[model samples]
Target: MLNIRCPYCEEDRPEIEFRNAGEAHIARPDEPDRVDDRQWADFLYTRDNPKGWHAERWRHVHGCGRFFNAVRHSVDDRILLTYKAGEPKPDIERMLREREA
Candidate 1:
């Protein structure tokens, strides 16, 4: 029902067209016991739950078979930006310009 941006096609695609993969840029600790409870908790539970400009990792399952980042707004349900898997995530305007170039 929601419209999600496909990082590959660089277009505002529907959510149904894509799949909801887990959090992005999550690196596990090298040593399990060395990591404290707070750190573990952060890895396990803490996520960027924001009202505006929330950065999340997404997979273009149906399109490019690539993973990228998306910046979206939760309150208004607007997708602000999208970027390639390795490309830097920027504001919507900057991302659009990067995609154009």
Candidate 2:
């Protein structure tokens, strides 16, 4: 059972209370009507499905009902950290470096 902390609620809840929304920080095009078909399709369908560390969006569906970001390891199914929506993505490389010091 994965214990996930909701950034908004500030409570560690069971994984069943949350839902993985998808990748985080995908910016929408400035002009939707002007976007080419290929570009538009890429934006909608493409994702960086990394096998290792990944930054993703999650919603505390049963709790706060707010969306947040989480850094997780795909292979291990471990969530490293969770942050509020609209917050800048964490600097993972820098964090790892700091952890080693």
lDDT of each: 0.72, 0.93
Per-prediction TM-score to the true structure, in the order listed? 0.66, 0.94
* Backbone clashes counted, model 1: 0
Residue-level lDDT tens digits of model 1 in 26-73: 767889799899999998888876665566778878777778877766
Steric clash pairs (candidate 2): none
Q: Which 10-residue window of candidate 2 scores lowest in summed lDDT?
A: 91-100
- For residue 101, model 1's alpha carbon misses the true position, in angstroms, by 21
Please report the candidate that would top TM-score against the real structure: 2
Each candidate's number of clashing pairs is 0, 0
> What CA RMSD would you report for each candidate?
4.5, 0.9
Highest lDDT: give the candidate number.
2
With candidate 1 superimposed using the best TM-score fit, by how many Å does residue 96's alpha carbon deviate from the native?
A: 13
